[model samples]
Target: MNGANLTLEVLKRYGVDTVFGYPGGAIMPLYDALYDSEVKHYLCRHEQGAAFSALGYAKASGKVGVCFATSGPGVTNLITGLADATADSVPVVAITGQVASPLMGTDAFQEIDVVGLSLAVTKHSFQVTEIEELESTLHKAFEIATSGRPGAVIVDIPKDLQLAEASSKPVLVETQELPVAQTDSIEKANQLLRHASKPVLYVGGGVSLGNAVEELRFFVQSTGLPSVSTLKGLGALDPQDHGYLGMIGMHGTKASNLAVQECDLLIAVGARFDDRVTGKLDEFAPRAKVIHFDVDPAEVSKLRPADVTVLGDFKKSLPKLTTEVDFSVWRKKCIELSEETGFKYLANANNPTGNIDPTSMLNELSQLMEQTSVITTDVGQHQMWVAQHMKFAEPRNLLTSGALGTMGFGLPAAIGAQMSRPDDCVIAVSGDGSFMMNVQELGTIKRFNLPVKILLIDNTKLGMVRQWQRLFFDKRFSETDLSDNPDFLQLAQAFDIQAETISQPGEVTGALQRMVKSENAYLLHVRINEDQNVWPLVPPNTANQAMLEG
Candidate 1:
């Protein structure tokens, strides 16, 4: 086999059945090789969308996703998606074409240093120069991407390398170990728990990586601990569980933030204390004894120092910790907090302020879709609203660019989700600003005839930024307005997709129901008033009681 064919063969052995990418000069030889291969490749409108689609596939399917791009702009466009994957620890393999090794630093046509640029964002990266190293390099990339807290791995293959022949045999790759958290420190954490009056469990993306949703549930159930989750940790606990506190941090619920503030022992599980989660680090959980547990040692004490730190995978540690800890007293405390807080959403709450209420729409959506429909969201007010309102009973039900918070993420992600689970219903909730960023992916969805439903919340402005401006910058608005959206109904129709426009509270349920039940891909343009904002927002560094009520 030629070098390009060999690379394709390696991918086939790895069980990579699908790929997303765009063809260009340096990557053309691989594309030609792909033609003779069995793998299915979807030609995305932009390289960025391709990367994000790969991410969506990985996040939803719980497997490594593959995407390829040409050199220069194509390679550069994938950086944001790579950064997002790394931050969330999603297993994604990104392959980009580069100029031949002979032109390494000469600024050859379409040449760019993708390895250097992607190094920090990726768990590991490589520039494969030798044909003999191709098989080994590809093997290691998958291993690194899937082992440990799974993260993105970038492999840059030069144009010349793709056409070269090598006599080297394929090499087998082995993972040395799954990243393990130290168990020696569990005793110290237990000591703190024993003495604590009020303790809280803060879960994050690591819990998802551990695939310990049931383990977390078992531990929480056994102890009855009130829990708060980072955005990435949503669905780690059953949203319907009474003991599960709502999400914590910037967009966190009122009761959850206040619970964190009042706790005597803060048990942070599989979570990094991000600045967004702990604004004004010195003042965060100041009086509590924090026990940090995570897969990555670097995450421990990186932001807030942990009184007790356990470095290991949550899956291994959680089951062991559950066996050793006694939570009868903890369960009683959690029950009291859950009852006192009554964090359940009240749909009829007074909203006399006249802003377009996104929560209302979210509640409507929740009512309309089944618990089985997998939902994806773009990062914005709508995303937070959905997180707060939608009830996720299953693992990996709600997919988003939580860690990276990428704006143009939903449509492509929806495409990937639909492709990954063709039998299941998939929905992408997007705001006008976010939808426009990658609305072109609508073509991809329509072309594939995937039954992915897109609910476009057309608020005519950047709602999240508008809210921030309202609170922080005296409502100056600035460049938050978005006035140039294509007539979405016509655009969808142009692509032969079923489309509808919905306005008013009375129409929301019927419109969503029709869209969700459609056999073909559909677009629902929800014309919400432009001035809406997400509510129950915990102002930066303020007490949770000071939450903004929409």
Candidate 2:
């Protein structure tokens, strides 16, 4: 068998049912092999789109996503997605076609050192020079990508290698088992949980990636502790759960931030103490004794030193750490804080003509969508609004570019997610500025007939940046104006996709219902006031408790 056929066989063995990519010169042989394979291939409009789509698939399905691209520009286009996956700890396998091995340093057509460029961004990378090493190399890549501390892995295969015949049949490689937590460490963590009066469970993306949501819910419910999550950890527990206090960080809810500030013991589960979540390291959870649990040992004390570090698989650690705790007083205080500082949106009844309030609209949309619906968003005020208003019932239901904060992530991500879970209702909630970043994916949607409802919030400016300038820069808006935006409804119509424009408050609910019920791809362009901002923001260098609200 040839290397290309062997590669496909290996992917199939690893249970990769779907892949996203754009075909090009050096990768033709692989595409040929893909044509006859049972695996589904989604041809994205661009290489970047292909990479992000793969990322979205990995994020939504807890499975290692795969993407293919040719040499040079194809590989270069994948850099952002690779970096994004690395930062967010999303497991992805990127396969890039290289110039023939004989090219050496001759600078052949489409030649580039993908391994060198990707080294900084990927968990591991391979330059497959020998056809004999192809199967093992791919197996290693998958193992490394999905194993402890999940991240992106790259395999750059030369064009000649793809065409080279293999001498023997490929064999499946066994994956390494994740390390278990030390019994003493688990005991230490339990001791802290047993003694604390004010304790907060801070969960992050790791819980979802580790497939430990059920365990996490059990632990939270068993302890009766208040919980808060990072942006990527939104759906680890149901938003309506009494223990959940919404997201924790810069745009975290007041209840979450205050709880973090006042907690006597902070139990960090699968969540790294990133700068965004900890505004000022010296002041963040100042009085709390930390108990950190993670699969990666390095992150245990990388930032905030842990009083007790349980390094192992969350699936094992979470259940063992579960203990009965009486925190009635702490829970009541948290409830009071939530009631005092909880989000309060302006009523739709008071909306003036022509200007719609985004908060009210998001609240309404959240109610209309199914509990199991998947919502993907680009980075902006709309993203924050969705995080605040939407109620997620399970992990991966709310997918966004958390660590990287990539602006163009929503549309392509939604495309990938819809393809992964064909029966689920997928919605792409994007700001006008974010939507335009990779708006060309509308073509991909139309081409594939993907029923992704695009809910575009057009505020006529870079809302997040403008809000920052207004608050911190003496109201100097600078070049943030985007008032001359194109008509998004017409843009969608140009792709032969149905679209509607809504500017008034009364038009929101009906338009949303229509868009959700539409059988075809649809875009509902919502126009709103440019001045609307995401509140409960923690200013740079300030403590999370020092939040500024509208």
Candidate 3:
């Protein structure tokens, strides 16, 4: 057996059945091995697409996503996706083939110091120097990625190692110990819980990342804590729960923003105080005494200082910190606010040109889609609209570029997610500009014949940037226009995917039903007014309480 064979075996043992990647000259040996391996490999048009697909797979499935890339340009192309994973704390293992060992530092072709370029983007970067270290290194990469707060890890294997003789060696997997929460800290948190009349639970993506969604929901139900979510934290709490207000942040629901500002105590669970979540840091949840719970000690007080910090695994910590709370008046107030200011599909006014309101359309789509279906989005107005108006059954159901906000994310991610969860309906909701960013990924869908649904929300402009330009920069709308976009129906047909277009406001439900119920890969081209902007915007550096409404 050669090293390439050993790598596959190691991955299989780690429970990875599928991977996404692109092949290059330096990585040809591994690709050759993959031809007959039990592991399935999907070739993507760009290395960036491969990486993003891996991210989508990981985010959607709660498993460590794996992607392969070869050499300098391939590795560089992976940087953006890695940065996105790093920022979102997604667990992904990226393997890249480096130039052969003999050509080290001689300015060899495609040699750009893969480890050096990726240190900032990965939790750990490994370069296999010796043949014996390959298996162990692969094992370590998976452990590092999944331990504590999940993160992306890179393993740079030199080309020579792929051809080296391989051995089936046994490596002991070390169990990582979780941080123990201090007894006094738990007592203090309980005391805060008992005293806080208007306490709110600020849930974040960490709840899902830590696999503590069930625990979180139980605690929320038991305590009857009024709650708000960060973008990534959207589905952590039941959307229909009495005390649950929708997402909170720049484009969050008004009730969430108002409630956060008015709360007397904030129980932050597995959530960081992000700038997007806290519009104005100084005034964010100002009146609340915070009790922060997280697995990572570094993030506990990184932004807003926690009055009580519980550092430990959430699965263990949530149980000990559970307390009895009575906030009937506070819960009622939040529910009233949510009902008054929440997104209502038919309630929103249509654009003068009769274009569909993205908020209303997304809410309608949310109702149309299966309860188990997954939704992924590229960065822009549509992403904010999805976050504000759509509903997800779980955090994993909404795969998006939350932290990095990468534009060309939706398509490739949908590719990864569909490949992983073939039974579930996966949809990529994108704006015209963001959709064009990685349109070549259409080939990937064609090659696999994967039943991934695409909802191209075209506004003939970079809607988010245009909105900012209109609101902040004198409405110049420069360079954001894409009025000359290719006919999307033809594009999908060229890829052998079914396609349809919808312009009338009345066509939304029927179009959504057709796309969702399609047996093959489908693309739904939705054209709305170019001037439409995401609502409930909290202008930069302002308090969430002072959000600028549409």
Q: In model 1, which residue pairs have backbone atoms overlapping below 3 Å?
A: 180-312, 181-311, 181-312, 181-313, 182-311
On lDDT, the candidate that comes out on top is 3
By lDDT: ranked, best first: 3, 2, 1
Clashes per candidate, residues 3 or more apart or on different chains: 5, 0, 0
Q: 1-550 in candidate 2: lDDT tens per residue?
A: 7888888888998899899998888888899999899988889988778888998888877788899999999999988988888989989999999988989468888888888899999999999989999999999999999988889999999989999997555557787788999999999999998889899999998899888999999878777889999988888976777668888989999999989998999999889999989999899999999999998888888989999999898898889986577897888888788878777766565666567888788888888888778899999999999988777888789889998899899999999888888888899999989999888889899889999999999988999999999999999999889999998878999999899998888788789899888888889999898888888899999999998887
Query: Can you give the lDDT of residue 77 in candidate 3?
Result: 97
Stretches > 4 Å off in candidate 2: 167-174, 347-354
lDDT of 2: 0.89
Tens digit of lDDT per residue, candidate 1, span 1-550? 7778888888888898999999899888799999978989988888888988998888888878899999999988888888988988899999888887888799989888887788889999989978889889999999999987788999999989998885558477787586565557876776777777778899887887888888888888777777888888888887766767788877777667777887888999888888778766777877889999877778888988899987776677776664345555755665566577544543423445433356776776777778778899998989998888777776577888887789999999888777777788899999999998998887798778788899888888998999899989998999998877778999999889999997665666667779988999989888887766677777887655456776
Model 3 lDDT tens row, 1-550: 8888899999999999999999997888899899999999989999999999999999988889999999999999999999999889999999899899999678899888988999998999999999999999999999999888878899988899998998988898785877778888899999999998999999999899878888888888888889999998989899879789988889888999999999989999888999999999999988999999988888978999999999887887887876666778889999999989877666233435477777787888898889999999999999998998888889989998988899999999999999888999999999999998899999999998899999999998888999999999998978988899999999999999999998888778788889999989999999988888888899999999999987
Q: In terms of TM-score, how similar is model 2 to the real structure?
A: 0.97
Q: C-alpha displacement of 257 in model 1, angstroms?
A: 0.8
> What lDDT is reached at residue 518 by model 2?
87
